[model samples]
Target: MTDAPRPRALGRKSIRPSLVPRDLMGDEELAGVWTAQVITLLPQAFPGVLGESLTGRALQEGVWALRTIDLREFGEGRHRNVDDTPAGGGAGMVLRADIGAKAMAEAVSRARGDVPRLLLSPRGRRFDQAMARDLARRDGVILFCGRFEGVDERLIEQFGLAEVSLGDFVLTGGEIAAQALLDATVRLMPRVLGNHHSAEEESFSSGLLEYPQYTKPAVWEGRAIPEVLLSGHHAKITAWRQAEAERLTKERRPDLWRDHLAKLGRPEEDREL
Candidate 1:
């Protein structure tokens, strides 16, 4: 009798050189899987929280992939220096343009397809759910995590890097922001989450903050689960959720509420009603 067809392995083929040992790399290079390429000084900082829970599970399963390009690997000089003092004189060192250009060139060469090369910066466009959704639909992304004061402007310009920020505030490095951005983007990929509906219903998916959720313990601390949720009426439950979501958005985020209204072609004045 002929043997049954073997199940395909989820692992990917390793296409690029890495400082990480092959065995510890978890998922190998798999074509078609969404990937995140990170350029950072602290190579060990990743997979970080991305290596836990659903995102971690996805990484292991080859549903997605992660490749960390150590910036220090491309550092100049015998000591492997990657940063220098600001040209006009600044309080902190700036990443050298020459070093950054070399690192970026390596990242570009390793890209599987046309992908975004992002720089995490305090002055860049604010990251949001829409951006996450957009990235999730792409082949992958290359993130450059800046350190010290920041990267040289010449490097940013030469590479045409898109600067993205988590908020107005700054951090010691871009590693944390890169992780956060990856977490947000990766979860939106197919099969990453246990239930696809989770992404569709989460906060900002509908252009409004998510409604509060309750589970079990029909009554908690003298408060009961919203009666509608207990009624077993699907229509009523959905309506209640939509109303609550709108109420929360209108009260807590006027800007979002206005945007939501505008999307629906409603006038801002109607929000008062």
Candidate 2:
């Protein structure tokens, strides 16, 4: 219904390199749109991957804030045993409900106070770019990363926690998925990415995967950037991008196409299936 973008504009590009990407050319920076608090058994897990990549550097510049909570602080005994066998004798241990709950409470207490508290679990809400965009608009969020089998179900019910799952499959711990969620969420914040349009045009930005992108020498191994991109025709370029996105969705993700049409209120469009 609209070509206009969200109203926030970019800030000056002259920020010190300490607060900006070293190689980023002069461009506007988005400031103070989000803060993130991550509660994890392993605080070291983050900045390991995030530090070297796009999102990590975004943190360095103060475009966003990241505060980590060490869940082991709530563990029992000196060894900080935070997980135990399930009461019914499951093969794997479930992260202790009480410990995790205590950790969650302390994490929220230490967080910005107004930020939303969320536990990263299979039981959590389904994560998607739309959801990512939604969460990024907030002041900040608290993320609880689980390990072993999972955290206690009672604690989740008690706190009315919002469950979030990365996908159908399971991972070793929620920390990685939390990071993935963090990366996806933070990138949508006002100025973390060099180009504001980047977030607007990426996969799921408009309910479709992105059009193919190409750069440089134009011709390489007989494959060239789409001629439409180089034609200097803005309308044609836009049309080509949209058509390619639709085509890619039709071929690779018919489900998305169905949803796209469903959103348009055209039930008859289901015939494309």
Candidate 3:
């Protein structure tokens, strides 16, 4: 087996912000590293939530790495203009293709064109747990955070950028979306969560939402913890959780429930009764 990666010498207060994709080209020491390069108009928004809790701990340990490519650095003109009025005219301006292309090309060149290039756009494929899991297995990912009304479509096609969406909703910018995506993927990395199975058992791992959880209190407010959960019988508890998960999915997300049935090619024991 390959040896585990040696953690970088990083501290909470010692973290330095990168102004450019200077090391866009992967170096020997970074080989096999699960890095995330975020190209954003707002660089400060990154490692925002990612620098907290378990994800933060993992980052300091070098289980993964983050770098930012400031889009404004590549903007045109004396004022560093990155946006312009939309083609054919629109109420709000759109990000310029030249700027987007330059930023993406530089990032891709640094990675030697092997990394997955993603653009955060609402019209892109819906982000899901499966996508997060898939990304966790990659060497690294490059994210382009669009601002203004949207990005120039030509740049996306020219760079072959895969647009990905957080949901059916809209966001002002892609910084938050990038952070959210990274958070989901990073936690799946080895040693990040401490308990790898925790990731597997969480929502969408088994194509269903997670079962409800209860803590120390045997009774809360007027409600007692489920008797099965408190019984300390591992087998019974597992079965109970499976049943609840199935029931909840069927009631709340019939689409997932149907897909789950299709994958299994038959009903699960929980649904049999």
lDDT of 2 by residue, 1-273 (tens): 877454333233234324435432112223443667788888877655666566766765556766677888888898999888899886989887788788777756655535777777776667999888878877788888888888888878776678889878888888888878888888777657888988889899899989988899899999888889999999999999999998898789888899998898987978958
Q: lDDT of candidate 2?
A: 0.76
Among all candidates shown, the one with the greatest lDDT: 1
- Give each model a TM-score: 0.91, 0.84, 0.86
Ranking by TM-score: 1, 3, 2
Stretch of 10 with least lDDT, candidate 2: 23-32
Provide the lowest-lDDT 10-residue window in model 1: 15-24
Give per-residue CA lDDT, model 3, range 1-273, as digits (tens). Answer: 997565344322223445553332223234456778889999867678888899887776567778888899998889999999988986999998988888887788767324799999999999999999889888789999978799989989898999999989999999988989899999998989978889989878999989999987788898989999989899999999999998889888877988888788865533643
Cα lDDT, model 1, residue 141: 97
Give the alpha-carbon lDDT of every model.
0.87, 0.76, 0.82
What candidate 1 gets wrong by more than 4 Å, as runs, is 1-5, 11-28, 270-273
lDDT of 1 by residue, 67-136 (tens): 8889998888899999988888769899999998988998798788768989999999999999999999
